[model samples]
Target: MASEAAATGSTNTGILGWIERSGNKLPDPVFLFFWLIGILIVISVIASLAGWAVQHPTELTEAGEPVVIAATSLLAAENIQRLWVDMPTTFTHFHPLGYVLVVMLGAGVAERAGLFGTAMRAGVRNAPTALLTPIVVLVGMLGNLAADAAYVVLIPLAGIIFHAAGRHPIAGIAASFAGVSGGFSANLLPGQLDALLFGITEASVETVFGDWTANIAGNWYFIAAMTFVFLPVIWFVTDRMIEPRLGKWNAEAAGNAMAEEQGDRPLTDGERMGLRWAGLAVLFVIGLWLLFTFGPGTPLIDEEATPEARLTPFYRSLVAGFFLLFLLAGWAYGKAAGVINDHRDLVKMMAGAMEDLAYYLVLAFAAAHFVAMFAWSNLGLVLAVNGADFLSSSGLPAWALLAAIILVSGLLNLFVGSASAKWALLAPVLVPMLMLLGISPEMATAAYRVGDSATNIITPLMVYFPLILIFCQRWQKDFGLGSLAATMLPYSIGLMLVGLALTIGWVALDLPLGPGASVFQEIPGTVNPVAPAAAQ
Candidate 1:
């Protein structure tokens, strides 16, 4: 007994040593993202001043149609001048600080009020060890519907739960991280990210197919199918492959105590009532949203109306709705739970939520500015046209093109963590090009989603990567980018393979990608010359 006790002490000390070392090696998340953003701005300014981006359009419109408008860059001072100012502003415009803060307000309420923790405990506690991998993966995948909360809460809790379960907590951390980040697009629900991507797809598809509509559910089934495929692959790799290689965790490295969570007060009578009311409030809010979205003549649904007349864009921008639902739910819960006694508590909750997001705000401001500049420079469009021509002339198979797309998207994810931003950059090119080949835009969107999601866990560019690293430090102490990369590599490969395989399966089945979007079709008014491209 004495020997065993001594060994345990030594082991714990080793673990703590590892964690401390890892923390020292890794760059701070806030600082890293901020630096990258700053660097991008500097490069954009240099290019603008160097006058290297000058390209005049040979023809502004094709076939007397308004479909193609090339930027006359470098050739005109007016073009370069506009690009200089507008480029950085793009990044700022989309990552709305106020919107992010408002959304976090609702999120903070649920987190602070014990709802998130309670739910997490309930989930991990009930899951059997054998089912743990799939369960963790599924939970993380589903959590995407809630936006960034998975990073904000789930990742750390996963480490704690694993430690309590008498297992290597880093394995647990990797599994959850895999599901949450790598499987981001695999959620059953079409959340804000989907809407953003679909909007870009719709706009791009319109160049070839005027009536193109990228529904929110465009990638739903593809994502769902990948979800199941990924779960087992993650389970097998993490349990049999990754964990075995990882060995035992040191004792001192047992991770943060589960004790802080232990004495948390149970829901009081008033709080219970508040929870019920909050649940109803949530239901009521969702009901109203559904009514507006699905109801006939409801402005939110667009009722077969024109772009201005349609509700598509309105429904697509559901982040505001997400903010409202949580706000009302949090308010009601706080009221019943007695945690919120007055308007002051409400204000405090919102303030607390906004405060933690300061780092994200800084990063987002720079990113937004960069994206704005990129768009203004028209480089993205020009690059897309040239790339599309190359792909077309190569006469490659659809599978080959898709495989290339997946690889390209995965590589791009290493630099750009925001899914929407990447899709925005890629969609305008991929969607229209794919349409010309007789491939549906929906399929293109699905392919992009798979690639974007697969690499998120391993990418330092992801906004949440540092947060995940910090969570890991609480358990292993030695964990760093290499550690995280090593641990997550298996899950990443699994998701990528399974996701890509499922995509190929969908194409083989000749299934509908979404409403009015199919994998293959004949080009309009052309029977002999089949449109060789697939709609992305």
Candidate 2:
């Protein structure tokens, strides 16, 4: 039956099909932004012409009247001068651009040297059959710390591992995909994503409060909780709902059973040795960061500042810390595995990493300009202030507002899968608007992640969606894109329901999202919530 369907089915249909069609019709994210820039310019002109204006939510005039702001046309002489003159500066100063490139610089070497694959394999190699799904799900979630390596390595390994364990290979694939992409933001540790999203958030926050900086770890605790909460959700859906429907595995019926074996192969002695060295590299990098933070001199600390402010430098150093950790670990593994013959080989791998990011560099250019022009036009501010006013007046509680953010973010994920690109677009409005309502940018970011992660698996527009579909077809042959979406639907719905509940519960509890990060924030242009003041 699976083979027959595989032979007959031609294209995607239903909701997934519509999404694929719509998304396909849209320009590439790079071009999408180029088009959006044009649209924004038109809107700015119209708004400027119509005399659209709003009272500054927080700014005050010298006489204490609310400062009124009118939209500035992007075509204004000054604006046009700024655009052409500052083009290079705008792209170079794009917030997430450096953070991603730096982190990936190290990650790419580690990937090339085979460290990420070995680690992922070691994670599930010997799990008991009863424990396989949970372990795979957990690893998939944890694998996020390794970035995109999880997608390229673990999911296929899972299919092979499951087949070797006598279960349906597709079940393994679904479970892995569910945890990896669907649970993209659920991790105990902050990685490149934290840097990327927070960089964008800081840019948004700066428009309202220039002195503010985003702590990349702002959503750490929330995402940590997300991991545990989502683990069982993926586990249950895969084992009970998805697997039963997939039925028992019959290799004969399985089409193109993936010219596979990496998962089945035992770690070579060299691989094991390399793993040990990489583990030590991680310890060394972490210990070095610890020394910088807590050892004598404490260059990463500022003695004259308040406690939170003192740790600001330390928080900022994590980005570099991650780069070193990956670079050293990858180099160590490559040396042990004989993959990197020398320093020149290391340079080549690092260069390859940036080469892979060419698309992101292009996308970032469009996004940076959009963000800059949006700030220049005063349109984001106008929208944020008025939007906040409407929401605050609507009388919905804070949790409902956040829940709405989650749903909207989830909806948007269906059309735009680049997390950084979308966050760069949304954060300008979402962050400042929520800040007006006494919600922190941290809380808003958390909500966006919850929505974004839960919907990743079900969305055909997600860049990796086609890859996941192909993985399914390798096992079942009959799995069309819709079939892939259908199999993953239960996992998506389960994750969404659970994720939403958790967000509401977190807000209700007023749990601190991370160290020095809270569910509420002092509105911009107002008092800071020092620990002592917060206690009072």
Candidate 3:
């Protein structure tokens, strides 16, 4: 795909060309994990033989002294036995796997029932032409709540809507892709990703601070802010930068006959009815959750707990809450839209959703093993301790360290496309290391998300990259990988810069990242050593 892009146009030459070529040669992400596991094993053996060890910064002996941790050789007889015996347990216990699968069970039903598609169409169709760009961008940003449905549904619909409005369809594709994939982490509401990533973050935090709890909405406010920040970036880049460069839409020249033929169709009576009911269903779900949260003897709040603990259940219930919301709304829309005649159809929709996750299940198995091995080797802790020591000695401003993390993560993203897999690998080291530097786990996670999402659009390895290209080809057959990359490069760069700036400013201002989440941590009897230096 990358080579096809490079060969098709001059727009993808230079750095874009190099990235495509290099990224295309990388192994499939699933295989890549197996290779990483092998490398990790070899490295563990070498480190163990070489007597590599670190002082456990957080864990102390009974005498109140720091403990020493030594590298455990993966080649050890006992370790090899445990690996064989615990293989199934490791895969099953993988955090992201369960979180994603559970959420998708509900999301899949919503998507397959036509609720997501109808909702997006309704949103875009109702917007005045003048507000189309921002509306499309906003819907695309919020579409993350539906997981992959946004990429498949919104990108193509944006193209058709633009063509009907006599604008460049490719520009619509650019705008939608920018919001859907490029600004992936930006959403007003927490979704499956929040649960999945925070699950990993919680695991990493527990490695250093055993009592820390996971909050799915740890970065909620920041991501909400990101949605607004990125909305303008996509709108301006699509309107002023990309569309002008492509010139006006040429109906005859542009091979988008199919799009032009379809034009803009008014929603059917059934769809309209379905949407109304779905809206009511959404409100009903929200009301139920509130009742559980704030009503007398609220089930979502623990009366016997401290004020902070009272909200923990509420926060944790959001995952199941969203599940019910999607499930009920989808069922309501399905019934009203005439897509579901009975309970059997709903069951089928749920089953179909699981069918689509077959590949992810396979990938998760390999990823789970790699993560388990990394933890067992104690290499993540050793690396975190050493890395934290290096950073502490360097005396770099905390913001600079965070900026560097975002940059590195963006660069690595060009090669590794799975957000969960990448986070699983990095969090073990980065989370604890930052914690040692007085940065909160949530802060480390926020910085990682900024970098992780910024370069998604330009990377061919992203699961949806080929799908986006296919969407583009519907408009211009000659539009190859390079064209897609070129079209999205500006958004990638702009959003990355904006995201980096947001991270730096958010840290400097010491704003709460989310409900009860902060940018810095205070260890008992120790000053917050990695506090951000005052802005110049």
Residue-level lDDT for 29 in candidate 3: 80
What tens-digit string does per-residue lDDT give for candidate 3 at 263-382?
456789998898899899999999999999898789988889987677888887877888888889998998999999999999999899899989988988997887778777888777
lDDT for 256 in candidate 3 is 50
Per-residue lDDT, model 2, residue 242, is 89
Q: Rank by lDDT, descending?
A: 2, 3, 1
| Candidate 3: pairs in clash | 5-482
lDDT of each candidate versus the true structure: 0.64, 0.85, 0.84
* Residue 79's lDDT in candidate 2: 99
C-alpha RMSD by candidate, in order = 8.0, 5.3, 4.5
Q: Model 2: per-residue lDDT, tens digit, 1-536? A: 33333333336566766786787687788888888899999999987877777777667899987777778999999999999999999999877888888899998999889898899899998889999999999999989877778987899889988887889988999999999998999999888888899989988987765657778888999999999999999999999998899888897664333534334578898899999999999999989988998999999899999976898898778889889999999999999988999999999999999998888888899999999999899888778877887787799999999999889888888888888878887999999889988999999999999999988998777767777777777776667867888898999899989989999999999999987799997766532111111123
lDDT of 1 at 316: 50
Ranking by TM-score: 2, 3, 1
After superposition of all CA atoms, the RMSD between model 3 and the true structure is 4.5
